[model samples]
Target chain A: MSNDKEWKRKLLRDMVVIRTFEETADKLTLRGKVAGGMHNSSGQEAVAVGTMSALDPKDVIATTHRSHHHTLAKGMDPKLVMAELFAKATGCSKGRGASMHLADVDNGNFGGNGIVGAGVGIAMGAAMGIKQLGHKKVSVGFVGDGGMNTGRTWEAINMAVVNKLPFICLVDNNQYAVETFIDRVTGGRDIAKRGAGFGLPSFTIDGQDVLKVNRYVKEARDRALAGEGPTLINALTYRYYGHNVGEKGQYRTQEEIADWRDNRDPIDRFSAQLISEGLLSQDEYVALHAEVTAQINAAVEFAEQSPYPDLSTIYEDVDSGLLGAKS
Target chain B: MSTQTETTRNTLPSYSEAFQQGVREEMYRNESIFILGTDLIERGGHFAQVRGIAQEFGLERVKDSPISEAAMVASGIGAGMYGCHPIIDLNFIDFSLGAMDEIINQAAKIRFMFGKPVPLVIRATSGVALGGAHHCNSLEVLFAHTPGLSVAVPSRAYDVKGLIKTALRAPDPVIFLMHKKLSGVRGEVGDENVLIPFGSAHTVQSGKDAAIITYGYTVVTAQKAAAKLAESGVSIEIIDLRTLYPLDEDAINETVKKFGRVVVADEAPLYGSITGDIASTATEENFKYLKGPIVRVGGIRAPISAHPQSAEAAIPTVESMINAVKKVLAY
Candidate 1:
């Protein structure tokens, strides 16, 4: 709330855009336009909008399969990204790359991977590249609590630490992996403490507060750029939707969802603070939501007009022609 | 740097030298190309294939990794997926299980699931040696079982070099099975940047009697049997299945029609082996072309033993290959 006018408005607009973007996608999916499922970051907008607000455009990001939030915040065209979800040719990856693998290399958006813990290695690789090129850019590996158990994640973390590579890993602990609660799945352990196990400094933050997430990420980014090794920011937030849009809510109680929605809502909490601090008007906030809807509508329109990919594209871009094993 | 002496150095080098040259060439060709694996640091590479590389390229380009083989392989896959051309060398075929997840799941499926081709080479040594059971065991069949993977087993120096270069240029994951036995084999390699694409076979010997099919180190064993069979007026055709996954099924059938008898020989166990697959498929598709039932020559189903006698017993010997040819001929 203390920030200057332009940045505050930019953050507010982006937050609204991300929220509206999710709702628009939900509607589109209902309309049969989006063939694949979307990972809704509806209630957790501040973590994405605020954390991404701190990073540089040239810096690379290694995101999970549910990566629309990171990609949108980082600057992929809404139309092309939507076209990708629709499996259309006009998408960034020519429709060959699906929802789980959206990428925009021009914007330093490394492709999202469906395999858990796979992106951690990519982030470490990017960090190594940073060292090789002597560039100031630090690679960010956005992981989830589910990925913490994968051996490859540990490999990436250890290598990054041993080499003192410039990187930041954001452990988005949404407190649940599918139906399993993090406390139960992780055996009552904190993800930040797990980072400390690898000897990397970890920051456990209130991810609901955009300012808190942004401040921590900026500090980590600055430290990495200064040659001070990797940092793991344990982002504590919750998802409004299920693990995916098609998730069956057989695990958690409606009571838990209600309590979180009522008490610690990210967007609602942030909006209240801004309104109370006189930084944003309630009427102006309503207008921002309307503007976000218009932007999303324009993107969907562009995507709908886009053509589908051809059959020839199936054989393209592969390095090897021996499609099957040569055993 | 070698372009000045390129013509002179372009002569047919041994498979080992050719392999070294291929990696050196790729590194020079692309700045993104780097090497990683165990035995790379104080020791050049575990197999001496990457020897003296560290002194030339230093530790960055020629990386030395810890004994954490799985992590090493996954990191290479990650780097390869991250838009870098990386060739990861596994110390031995036996140690490959350490990196199985990355090789099987991540590296292989990345392009298929995500539609981003992982341009990478996993160059490793396999097959029996006087070098004990651990050093032995050609598990190319295991990798060949996986989808979206290309397995290249080069017996000749020309193939060793050309295949490595081809693998580097490929967008899909390539498993280059370097036969430890054929490391010293040399031939007059061509002067051009040769590429022997997949889906073909090398008929080491052309004969009209019985056809014996094999690959990797067993190709030599099959050749030995063919040479002996030729002395008996029984012409034998040796089909070296250089690459295994996208198998040359057409070639196998065509050869079976010509010879009317086929025998599959391999160094690995018979069950679920490439040799078994070939034998079964040949029987089903080319049954009428059969002079006899397809007999397969392979090791017994068990882990390789350390004793030389047991190890020899575990492989498809030249004698066994000859015996297999006779049984097929009798049919």
Candidate 2:
């Protein structure tokens, strides 16, 4: 086991950073800083931080459109991410991929897909590459519960299991697909149970509990690396805001939001754990907030100063002509 | 005694044999290229096209899937997107609607989206010989209209071999459509050396009277119709536009200039047939080459009728095509 003090502080910092950055994005949206629709991962920070902490940085991970947390948790420079949201040339994808499709492939981040359930297949393919090269790395595909029912997801899952692939599907189940509650659309309340029927090894956990989520992620990663095949983990969490910044979701009432925010908020929960364990003082936690705020402000400044991509980017990448030359 | 006696070597198989042979060779050559479809294994494929493929390729690479059209296409896209080069068989073209999203949106867009092209082969066979409405339809025009996909309707075995070989090497996903009626129809094919370029169209027969232009199963029909017209003192040029999507518009234009009259025949509905596109384009741009208006022949825009008399009236036939040629001559 690692030192309780160091691990707890790290998890707390990650949760705060993720929450703060996304909140800043919401503010930017209000201020006309961002042009496109934004999918907020405000209430789902712990899953990203906890799962990423357990995996190796060299290991490849993929996500769907709502992928700010995954990118930030993987140690991307906040300034670059902010610049990307700003659609600046200095952004991570060189201002090409805005929020829904940000990518820093050189850092082992497969870009997020705008299409549902697309990344599940890609993750298996990446794992197959790792197998072909005889490497110890594994792949993690983080998708939402809405993507679980797609035919492509099933295709990838079946192939992953049959090939004995070293892949893990991190089910980021926030209990809503935009506005529809999970129960309204799906049969059962649990997504991990559905995964079990696919012949995948699975587990469900309190996704807001950073420490607990990290423990299971580590176990899954080790099992995958040893060629034990894929594992599906249904992360049980909640979202504080609507699907995007423009949403005013009337689906969930005030009572539910109040309860989840007060009791199960991951950042506050992790901080409490740190303080109770004598790892972080109250003043130290307060100071960490100030530092995170400064970082967000600096990121906003860099984004404001950055340039948009030139129009020629449209024709640059579609064809490399590797298969055969076109006449 | 003649001391200089030379022995000539003969080896290449016909085009269809080469395609059938290539599947076997490539399966043996690479472990990852899998051949999958519905009931293909027990039926030895719908037209015996993949007969003995499983025996030579083994069960792993040659697998039979359920009757789930969307699942098969989605899986093929998934597998191929990662690393596997999958050759998927849609038993009939009409059922392609079920998996259109997977085929059009996901499989075709990935290369352009991620800035890395995915190489996959999609094989389809379609027609109305059978009584099943689900099984009886000609929808090649649907795929030909999709932007990112490349499609081919090989009218002969030589084309089957060359195009399949070429399609296997295409980084962009391709649809290899073979008309069901032309399955066993044979011709001279190569063993392993032919590369049918995607946009190359061939003029099968040359004539000054008119050009009978078409593709897929209609090539043979047009040729038969041309033969009938030839005996009646009509010279008709039969042109086969093998590749559909990256259509050889240039060749079609040059041929139209040489032969001032043409009859565009197809198996799809006449309303939006690829024949309509060609005729409309030629009329708009190559009006100078026209000594007569282009005649269009195809299904009369209705579901294929299983009843023989009604079915005969539904889609275009050899006699109907000949009638169309006469109409073009009058024009």
Candidate 3:
């Protein structure tokens, strides 16, 4: 919309890479190559890509179990992320944290948390530090609809609001948390409206649209950096697959899933919009998809060839002083 | 406790004041160090362990938090992850149960799980002083059982100052347990700037007939027992394990080898207590040196009561330590 062709292309490219990375991760998880459960970020690509694109590289992010897309969008190396998923020594966490706990603090990605709404407090703490250090950086915490209901999330939001920390509590309301629908569990079913209880700029937005997500996040970032306090955003989106890779998804209807996947797919909608706006060509989109697919495949190869951590190093990194530095 | 050599003019400060002195010194030394806890700013902490710190370092660093222990702890973990050394003050150690998930799952494991240093300290006032079940809890074993957390239980003013300074500078999360009863207890404090390394044992009293290994408030009880036992010609050695996680196995072994009889005591309940760890280490590491079955003196397996007599009977007393020492010396 702003006539920034290169920037639009880059956004599209980042989303494509996330989608490819998630899809490949799903395949690997399905094939039993990756250990443990993997929460795919396939349908929620716009949330991670759009939100990350709105912030500076120095800004930090704390995400949830469904964190592959966020990790890639946050500028983590695909090979390192893939190797982490593969539980290899070459992984970002050195094979310690698999799918659920992927973190690279040096890259400003505080890492993916397994506990619901846990990262919100972490992000709040980072914001507290940022404010104390007088840094103009923002910290974003990504949670699901279920994580929104967590008591600590509200507690953290209240503290952030009171302290006016540069924080953003971004909720990806994918309509379902595991097998339960959000409405079935959440009372009143309005996550954003509750933000007024703490007196902050809070709203719900169309998460499937990249531009809207980016714009909202950009405004939130601006408010945070300006010392206007925290923002709570509930972005409504959907998941294309089950909660985990191997679930039957009996909790959701096939028609509903099909409708979201076919009609409301974020990447497809954004690509179409980009093409119509002359920001991207159909031929270029196809080439970009192929390029990202090849990159993801190469990452898989690197993960496959990566070595598992040695048994002798089981106790390593438990104490920082024991290991002079990270191996 | 004659441990660190006298290098500067010694001052007699209460346990709580020494803790504040340690925190104040560290806050001045490190700009990244900040404190988050309940009643820290207005009430100056329930135990006054952080008294005058808010005025010294400003409210931004020594900030008060709501009653949300979980969020407070998680925030500290997050801040520590971001290169800020946060001292999360849980007013009472019993209240730490509210944030077990954050403490065990997040703070304790994040460093190991993420392969990054979390320079954070969880400061809590521990031990029973007729505070009842809700207030009296010695969770040293619970934290000591968990890996990646350095547990420091300082009984004296000197150890409180030095150990806390070390905890503030630790590259990992440290559970700094201060005794509630010892808050007003006065003791000799060492140099203001020196730090006491964790895992080192302080020899409270030198003896040869028997050894009583203890920490926290139990150290005082052990000292009383040693005084009584010394009159009976059973010279008992007292070893104060300043930090429990790095359990000072070498010191325990040395004491075991020298005395050939041992009694491990702790204020926590005997079931799943750090006393078991100390007793096991004594037998396991110094089996040949031991002359008798290692006796353990700890709190009774029951909820600590508010009644003064019942509370006194709940945790290890001077009489209990005397019995434990005598039981081991029978060999």
Point out where model 3 deviates above 4 Å.
Answer: A1-3, A322-327, B1-11
Best by lDDT: 3
Q: B221 in model 2: Cα distance from truth in Å? A: 1.4
TM-scores for every predicted model: 0.86, 0.87, 0.96
Runs with alpha carbons beyond 4 Å of true place in candidate 2: A1-13, A56-62, A74-97, A103-111, A121-138, A149-165, A225-227, A278-306, A312-327, B1-17, B25-32, B39-44, B57-60, B66-68
> Candidate 2 lDDT, tens digit per residue, B88-164?
88777776787777678666666655555666778878765656566677777777787567888888888887778
B1-331: candidate 1 lDDT, tens digit per residue: 6775756555657677778777777777787788877777677775567777778778778876756656666656656666677787887767888778778866776675455667778888888877776788778888888877789887887777767776777676788888887877766564336656675787888888888888888888888888887788888888887788667788899988888788888888787778888888888998887877888888788878878788888888878888888888887
> lDDT by residue for model 3 over A1-327, one digit each (tens)?
555888888888988898888888988898998878599888998888889999999998888888998888888889999999999999988888889888989878888988998888888878888887888899999989999888888888988998898999999889888989999999877888888777889989999988899999999999998999999989999988889997786788899999998999898998899899888889999999999999999999999999999989998777766311111
Candidate 1 vs candidate 3: the TM-score winner is 3
Runs in model 1 lying further than 4 Å from the true structure: A1-4, A27-36, A88-97, A133-136, A246-250, A273-279, A299-327, B1-15, B112-116, B128-137, B145-147, B182-200, B245-254, B276-295, B299-301, B306-308
True contacts kept of each: 0.23, 0.16, 0.54
CA shift of A285, model 2, Å: 4.4
**Model 3 per-residue lDDT tens digits across residues B254-287:** 8888888888888788998888878886788789
User: With candidate 3 superimposed using the best TM-score fit, by how many Å does residue B192's alpha carbon deviate from the native?
Assistant: 2.9
